[model samples]
Target: MLALPTLSSNGITLKPLTLSNATDLAEACQDGELWKINETSVPEPDKVMDYINTAASMPDRQAFVVIDDLTGKAIGSTSFHDILPFVKRLEIGYTWYAKSYWRTHVNTTCKLMLLTYIFETLEYQTVGWRTNIGNHRSQQAIERLGAKKDGVIRGNRVCRNGVISDTVMYSLIKSEWLPVKLELTKKLNDAH
Candidate 1:
């Protein structure tokens, strides 16, 4: 069992998913339009509590509501799922943000914090991402993070709206993390 660390970076913090987060998560899920770039569609507020509870119960899945300590509000959500500890790999997905945080440093900072943990702390060899092929913004974002394009898996995934779609695979191996992390940090700092 991997113990999750209390992670914080640049005023952004990640708290483990819990029943206490239901309302804030439900409210964040109200930004349904953000699903355009998010492969998983946001659930209705009425369903968020159950959805979050279910996530909290999953042994291999851990979700976090991205919070900004400045205003003490949840700005978005991200998760580490598809954990394969024996193989030392985990897929980072199910990420989205409120409109106010988009195009800001929040996303990168969140990724930086999470990747730092996954690669450095956990000593995990690989971190992977799968994005809907049609989601160009997500594809670009993953690329900008310096993940290597491993090629597309045609018709590899299904969307929330019940549409079958291809997935573009990207990954960062442990050996490649240093340069990428340096580049990502520079980009994030330049933006600040």
Candidate 2:
């Protein structure tokens, strides 16, 4: 059976990706600043529909559209992918925020909600995060989440742009989550 895909907290909501979401998905991908840090280009409408269809059909990929509760608009995307049931592990990836929402409460709320769902709801023992080594912004965000820096995987994978990037890895184990989550929550709640 498939795990039901919906998670919400405070005013943030995460819902499963759908073909109807292509327009917002494309808009989220418009900012070149975000694209520079990501490995894949934000797809065109037709391409986004393909992404939605393919992702929804994938048994292991639990993709969600990050929606702002107040405005009810799609602002970004995130997913629990590379899930390994036997090992009780999952990877939080393919995350991108609309440029306007960057460094806002929205981002923090989203991360906190996702972590809560992953470690508490899904009972995942470990959650992994990785980014292209050249993407310092992403590296900083991962570290800020209290994820321990694991070694980088050299020539880890090729980007959609056809360039190979060494991926810097980070992870948080369940044993380490409570305190870390507490700290992150505090930081996210505090005035920035």
Candidate 3:
């Protein structure tokens, strides 16, 4: 099993998600009733435990709760899923934040942290992202992080609303990391 260490920077932290995070996760999800969204994997308030348990049992996934450093609150969640250590690759998905955090520096900071850790510390060669094809916001966010659109997967998976959705794929290989990292860093620095 892969162990995820707590990572923090730029006023946010990503800590390994645990069953104990049920309350925080529920509260975060309630911010915009995120579970009502058909495309995301966010669990309803009553399903938080099941969500965490499932995440814990998944050998290929390491989930993290996004915490706001100054407020010490769990504001969102993201994960390193579809791990393939043999190929030094993984996908970053199952991510969502309270609606309030949208359009802020949080997403960019988290991406920078995760990408740096994967490319530099873990020496992972590729990081990929997948989103519901209808989720334009998510696609934009992933693209802004410098991931190239790989293509689409038809009938990828059943969404929360029980609809089979097409998945839009994106990726960033190691060779593309340095410039992306620099751009992300510059964005974060320029934000202040």
Question: Which candidate order results from sorting by TM-score in descending order?
Answer: 3, 1, 2
Instruction: lDDT for model 2, please.
Output: 0.78
Which residue pairs in candidate 2 collide?
Answer: none
The weakest ten consecutive residues by lDDT in model 1 span 32-41
TM-score preference between candidates 2 and 3, better one = 3
Q: What Cα-based lDDT does every candidate model obtain?
A: 0.82, 0.78, 0.93
* Candidate 3 C-alpha lDDT tens digits along 23-47: 9889999999999989898899999
List the candidate 2 regions with Cα displacement exceeding 4 Å.
31-33, 36-41, 44-46
* TM-scores for every candidate against the unseen true structure: 0.91, 0.89, 0.98
Global lDDT of model 1: 0.82
Provide the lDDT at 66 for model 1. Answer: 90
TM-score of candidate 1 against the unseen true structure:
0.91
Best by lDDT: 3
**Residue 13 CA error for candidate 3 (Å)?**
0.8
- What's the residue-level lDDT of 133 in candidate 2? 86
> After aligning candidate 3 to the native by TM-score, how far in Å is the CA of 1 from where it should be?
2.8
Q: Write the per-residue lDDT of candidate 1 for residues 53-125, one digit (tens) a residue.
A: 7777888888888998898877677889889998899988878777667778888999999999999899999
